[model samples]
Target: MLKIQNLHKSYSTPQGPLPVLQGIDLNVARGSSLALMGESGSGKSTLLHLIAGLDQADSGSIQVAGQDLGQLSESQLAGWRRSGIGLIFQQFNLISSLSVADNLAFQARLAGRHDRHWQAELTQRLGLTQLLERYPEQLSGGQQQRVALGRALAARPALVLADEPTGSLDEASSNEVLQLLLELLDEQATTLLMVTHSPRVAARLQRRVTLSNGRLAPADGL
Candidate 1:
């Protein structure tokens, strides 16, 4: 569902251009999950941003469902993102004033594909039915992250990009969150590309690839 070919991105600095992603070639299959592992400053998040249309690559192509991201105008990209991509960051990013129910329904409403039935099911499956009336600040980190996932998936986006999704939780919470994510992704046949530093986290995905020096490489067993 997603493809990247020789993609390159760099940032301007006092010391000249700081190359981040160099020749990043990757392809993610439909209904599959991939773990992107790398050390700090390895450009994993940069690659995800490019694919999500939040940032443009300096060179090469990032194609999602046959559409080249680089070619889209900012307005077009905004629409594209609303329709096709679901993003979950390390931070919950939930609206502080919105209750869980509103937070979960936010994305679907924006995409104009709000389905009460689907959102209901997601809330139940994510074990968030009771918390619908609560706010983000009232929940634990894992609970908040589950709410974030619910918000993202509520739109039924074809692809999900998660950057260090479980980075803020404890081990048990991380495992629970990851398990729920896999189960939901399987049920919906959604594609996932998550950036994480934990081997335990990466090992659960269908495949893992390590990013190094702005390039992709097959990672040996964790």
Candidate 2:
């Protein structure tokens, strides 16, 4: 469902061009999950951003669900991102002004795929029924993360891209949230590409790849 080839990216620093990703190639099948592992500054997050079309690569190609992302115009990319991809980040990124219910339904509504029944089910599954009226500042980190997960999945997008999703949670909370995420993804048959540093967390996915020095390799030795 996702493919990347010879991907290269760099950033302009005061000194020179700082390379982030170097000739990276990857393929993830439909309905499968892949974990991306790496150390700090290893380009894991950069790769995810490139795949999500939030940033452009200096070279190479990214194709998702048969559409070449490089070919899409800015407006088209925005529309595709709204309807075809669900993204969860390390930070909650919830709208502090909106209530939990509104945050959860925000993406789905934007995608024009809002389903009252489905959202209601997500609320219950995420243990958010009672917190619907609460705002982000009023919720705990774990609770806020759950709300973010609910928002991402409420739209039932074809692909889910998560970057350090459990980074801010404790071990127990992380395990709980990861399990729930996998269960929900399975039910929806959505493909997953998650960037995480924890081996324990990566082990839960169908496959794992490690990024080192901006290159991809099997996670076995990682």
On lDDT, the leading prediction is 2
State in Å the error of residue 144, model 1: 0.3
Q: Over the stretch 1-222, how does candidate 2's per-residue lDDT look in tens digits?
A: 999999999999999999999999999999999999989889999999999999999999999999999999999999999999999999989999999999999999999999999999999999999999999999988999999999999999999999999999999999889999999999999999999999999999999999998899999852
Residue pairs in steric clash, candidate 1? none
Candidate 1 error regions (>4 Å): none
User: Candidate 2: deviation at residue 124, Å?
Assistant: 0.7
lDDT per residue (tens digit) for residues 1-222 in model 1 = 998899989999999999998898899999999999999999999888889999888899999999998888999999988889899999989999999999999999999999999999999989999999999999999999999999999998899999999999999999999999998889889999999999999999999999998788988752
What's the alpha carbon RMSD for model 2? 1.1
Question: Each prediction's Cα lDDT score?
Answer: 0.93, 0.95
**Clash counts for all predictions:** 0, 0
TM-score of 2: 0.98
**Segments of candidate 2 deviating more than 4 angstroms:** none
